[model samples]
Target: MTSPHRPASHGIPRPRVWAPLHYPGFATLFIGYSVSSLGNGMSAVAVAWLAIELAHGHGAGLLIGEAVAAYTLPGVLVALGASRVLKCLDPRLIILVDAIFRAVSLALIAGLALTDTLSPILYVSLLGCSSLFGLLGIAGDLAATTELLPSELHVAANSLNSVTSFSASIGGPAVAGVLIAALGPGLVFAIDAATYVLLAGAVLASRRYQPPTPIVKSSSAGIRDGLRALWRFPALGAITLLCVIFYGLYGPVEVAVPLYVSSVLHASASVLGGYWTVFALGATLDALGATSIQRFGLWRMTIAAVAAWGVCLIPLGFTTSAVIGFIAMSVGGLVYGPFIPLKKTIIQRSAPGELLTQVAAASGVFTVSASPVGAALGGPLVAALGARATLAFSGLATVTTALVAVAVLLAYRRRTRKLSGDR
Candidate 1:
């Protein structure tokens, strides 16, 4: 396939921001991806609530913590093994199979919940099992997108992907909360299950998206190949490291925000939802403006995003007013949203397409690997220091990491230029 920046046709004008949708297959893929993301978002809320409910207020915190941990942490192990699966299987088949697996798992969980047989261990196990496929699905989905569209549209398309995720996240929790209030968490799981069916259908319909021929595998292709491939691309490797640290440090925000709301602001759950919604809104807005930011260098934009995230979190840490917190979170989200899409686009452009799935899977491992670590640290830090103080430290640490990144990136670029000159 031609590079993303290449002209669509000799005499044709450059494609606009929404150009990817014009490709019928990509449109189908986007629809499916969005639907699936919405379900994932709803599940994010439902699973934690179910865990707490199953706890019967006994060790509810630990139950919910385990459930959350189960939902994501298992994906790390799955990602480590996913490169082998992606290497041996059709990426399209991998995505479709994952959707099927998740749909069945959710349906079973919904049934179990309704039957009042869902134990906390059982619930966490089911979610964790389903998430095994989740990591593989993400790797396949990104590789599929990179294959379906020309490389030039990667940024716009990824921006659209981000918008779908952020929009779903904003809307999903609100809808799930209401549904849970009226019908309980079981029904929400059922609905989320239905959405996965929709995702599966979309994947099936995208059969027309034929990827370019994959690289011929040598006998040595194995689990370690993904990480090795990632390191081979210096720019992508650096960017991926930056993403890991940022998410690692930002992990505390997940724990700290809710604590801050409950402890400091003495706010209602609605206030917590409002904070998340505003942040999602900011991310949605940033996704919309991604086309405008395309003129800037990716590394520059990435650094700025990291810096802005740290700066924005300061107000969130210090603020006593919900209004100020909302504004701060919104701005933080705005700055943070672009970094992810930017990171993905950079990886897509820089990495070999044939290794894209493995590289992405490896990237996922690095990116989320820190969340559990941060959570482990965050619990203690919050206990020792107030949630507000914990947030400030997280923010400051992220900014410092970003500053270190600036130096590292600058040096890397200079060395690369010198090497090219020598050549």
Candidate 2:
């Protein structure tokens, strides 16, 4: 059996957190992905803002919702069909194709906007087209990470990815706000399109450094194979379930937090912004330092994080002070940061290499949907319980879910151990 802790280097001292970047191929991919993610973060704001600009008076809210949905919902469908459509392609090729498609679609949207010909309908349709391959792109990126770095560095690599995403979330919107005021959302979309072209070029340039592609037996069962893999692997299934619940529970925070700040605390938009900014900063810090907790075990770390996140949210539920709310959100972000990296690390380690992308896509289908469903449900929850109570309810429910998960997982582990002993 192979040990899991093999060093990236033979003898020279190197920081474990940055170990994955030492590889040239991964480093190139990281830089391109980082640049592109910043663009993505900007688009997250620009898309909705542009939707607001184009929407007519009576239908503005509906059109904005449609535009946002167009950007995200297609990725769920793409992830669902990935096993069938993407089974034969190299992960890197999938990434390349996805990037090119995004670049073209976003460029088209930009062109239409610049020419003043972009209708709301066309804008929504193009946004949908742009995201059709989004989930596959993410699956390919993670699959490529496994290929580019050793197993031990996966957590660090994933954490670095998380850090980039969090940082972009902070910086992208701020930049987009400024750019949209000066150059308009159309030009921002053009900049975003350019970033995807750069990503495509990076993918092309990294070809020489990538190891020879491994042959995977093609599957016709579509996502069922990935689902079956989850059922067949106990650990994978458990972690996926935990993630679904965890994310689902967090969705209400998105809906409730702003409401809480406004209705309960009587605060301004700037206060809400400040609360989230602090949260993102804490999350970024935690993600940057994720490698330090590797020895404590990913499973324990995930569970602990979930529980701590719940505890953090409890404070917000009871507090009327903006300062207390900010502190709670900051701590919540710290605990929440490790959840994604840890989940990806476990999935990458547990799944067979050939099935990795499919497994990830399959997992994405559930995890991606979880939050939206929770957010949709949050409307009724907030109505019934009010914002402060809703926050408390989400936290309490999340803690209970984590406790139940722990008991179930422990029982399953003991049973597996006993069965192994008998065999």
| TM-score leader | 2
Candidate that would win on lDDT = 2
Scored by lDDT, model 1 comes in at 0.80
lDDT of all predictions: 0.80, 0.84
For each candidate in turn, the TM-score is 0.92, 0.95
- Compose the digit string of candidate 1's lDDT tens values, residues 145-193: 7878886677788889989999999888878889999989999899888
* Tens digits of lDDT, candidate 2, 1-423: 011222212222334888898998889888889999999989988998899889856688888889988888898887776666667777777788889988999999999998889999899999999999888888888889988887778888999999999999899999999999998899989999999999998887777777548757674665777888788877778888888998898888889998998999998999998988888888988986567775667777778889989989988888899989888889888988888787787888777777888878888888888998888888888989999999998899889988987888688768877987999
In model 1, the runs with Cα more than 4 Å from the true position are 1-15, 209-215
Q: How close is candidate 1 to the true structure, as a TM-score?
A: 0.92
